[model samples]
Target chain A: MQVRCPHCASVFPSDRAGTQFCPRCGAQIHVPEEGQVVEAGLPPFAPGAPPEPSGAEGPGPGEGPTPALPPGVREPTPWERRRELGLFKAVVETWKASVLSPRRFWPSVRPEAPWTEALLYGWLIGAVTSIASIPLRVWQQRRSVDELREAAERLEELPARLRDILRPIVESAGAGTTGDVVAQAILGALLWPVGFIILAAVLHLCCLLVGASRGGFGATARAVGYAWGPMVILYLPFIGWLGWVYAAVLAAWGVKELHETTWERAVGAVVIPFVVVCCFACCLGMAGVGAAFSSLRASP
Target chain B: MHLHLPPRNRTFGFVDALGVTGAVGLAIARWVPVARIVPFWGCVLREQTGWPCLGCGLTRAADRFAHGDFIGALQANPLGAVAAAFFALCVVASALHLAFGVPLPEVRLSPREARGARWALVVAVVLNYAFVVVQTRFPHLLA
Candidate 1:
């Protein structure tokens, strides 16, 4: 039987009744007996689309039990309560919840919240992390150049063939200047949002491909944004990249909770894209090698 | 990946895995004479084509970077040197985080941004390959 979600006004085909999750909005819906079925002609929201405006009141109390904070209702993250908590506190609370207490935190993440809010949070974290890590990356690059130049001075003692081969490497060592590093750093900070958004899209696409994405793109975007909590490690020396792993795991958890999907599907949504990209890159690389071999043979 | 991190002291779960893998990798790189064992381990593309492949000098670059010969690593392959430094950084950072219980942050992106990152990576790879070609085939221009 077709039942309309009283909370979000989304209509979906349902065979079973009782306390069940709306595939579209993930709201806990209580379907009534066939005699009590009210055929409301409200325009249904698209499947996996953001919740409609709350102007439409749910069925009178007689219809069923209404959840206090309906899944269709937008539950604002701490970062969104900047006016009440102040900006710093909001950021801190949100980051803490996302990274440390994700099990409790992800369920609170509403798929209906404006995706831009999460996007802004991710942007702030990424920009800060990039700016903080610049010093370390710059130091590493500088050390690399200095070491190369020193080795070049001793190249004279090496065999002629080896020296000839090493000369180009030495020449290119100084290719990146301080100015260049600064420019790259600035670009990275500015482009943080773009990178994050793309990552979320890829993951969402994977979710869709695997038939796992129950929530709209907004949910996926929010998941990826909140996942930025782990990226703070970027500010520290060494283990910054581990933030990527942690963030990925957090995002997957968020998807499972917000989308109301299984762990296998949520994890698959994240892993499939990575596997596909790696396989594609390997093939592309092999093709390049093959082309190079053919060109070499043709030249002779 | 269904790898759950406990609510409270989450650092211990994966720290051991990272520590073991990193230690084993470093030990092999430091103690084992991999270069001697694989004497013919050179870039086949470079050997036949007179032009350097994207990964042509990566091994040499890694070896130099591992030995604290940053300059030699850069001279061999700038990308490879960067990668080696990044690997070392991850190992050390993971160890410290496990020891100190530092909090990690999560990161998320929108679809547009994800596409942009992929494009940016592609551009970086192409640019790096171009640099390798210029340095190898036309060294005078750089000089």
Candidate 2:
């Protein structure tokens, strides 16, 4: 008997009449007996014809306005369809959805689209943010330099160790010219693609370690690329770090939706690597302290 | 495992994008004095805590590897050397795949194999960290 999955609309033949998993997407479904199929509003299966998605019919009654995708199916983002909608509109729409409504947006974003398209979207955001924020960053740097100088001058009253610690920061902050800051901004912006790829590789490795990378590296890469949407407003000084936090949140959501995994696994995949790095650093720091103490004692 | 040949007209994929970006980053690192222009303060972990971080010599390793000093890169950071070599491999693989339509071989591991690989990775990272610590702190032992 032919059974049509109400979720993804994929039709397949089932010999038995019980619960089984969908062949295409691995989703669980119930197989009804002959003439027992009673899914409302779902189209009947026609052999040799491509399965039509219920999303084409729009949301049913009592459903929310957001066109939520069914499990195991995804549509292309506005950015991926830029040829059809003009580039500017696509970029805006994609950015809006990614930053404002990631839960709805990420599930709908087709993970299998060419990764370069996603990287291009991220690069565009990074480049624009860097270019637009150059003056602001330069102004901030100048202000910080003055503040550091003031703090450095008052450091003599503090403990000797504290003074020693802050002196390098003050010196480093005061040393850079505005031209260097501008150059740094430009170069940092240009390196976004490489940085995103490297980040995705690390995150994907973490995902694999945590058993959350069911959708493969392409999906992870796409998620990381689109997660940069929040960084569009990284120019805002006080709220800039908040935007970064939101970007990380969106990345977690992206992994969850793209990989069709539980929230726990997704969050673990993102957080575990950083935690490991921190712990490793702490251990190394302790070892270094030990070595320093031993060397000091030996010298005497 | 079975081999899956990609379609003739494949779109730009993860490896391809990674290859392009990694190659560009390496090229810039090779030619440009990025470290000098950026005014990077040395690592805070090393400076304040009297310890070398896990990524202590990664920059020097990348710099050395960019100039074809493989042994020097390994001496600096074994993992960094491995990563540099992987990036170089990606460049070559991406070129062949993009230009000649040659598909990269896909390896699929079973659940048991994947578990083993994960453990192996953890062991490798720990071993590499030990190497980094000894090389940085007790150089005489290595010598």
Largest TM-score belongs to which candidate? 2
TM-score of chain B of 1: 0.79
Tens-place lDDT digits, model 2, residues A186-234: 9988888778877887787677767666566777888888999889778
Candidates 1 onward: DockQ, in order? 0.02, 0.20
How many angstroms is residue B25 displaced in model 1 relative to the true structure, after the best TM-score fit?
Answer: 35
Q: Please provide, for model 1 over A222-292, each residue's C-alpha lDDT reduced to its tens digit, 9 standing for 90 to 100.
A: 88899888988864657876887898899889887766666887898888776766754664566545644
Local error of candidate 2 at residue B71 (angstroms): 3.4
Question: Which segments of candidate 2 are over 4 A away from where they belong?
Answer: A1-73, A81-89, A148-172, A175-191, A272-300, B2-11, B18-64, B75-77, B99-101, B130-143
TM-score per model over all chains: 0.48, 0.66
- State the lDDT of candidate 2 residue by residue for B47-103, as single tens digits: 556568777787788889999999999998899888888888878878988898877
* RMSD (Cα, Å) of model 2: 10.6
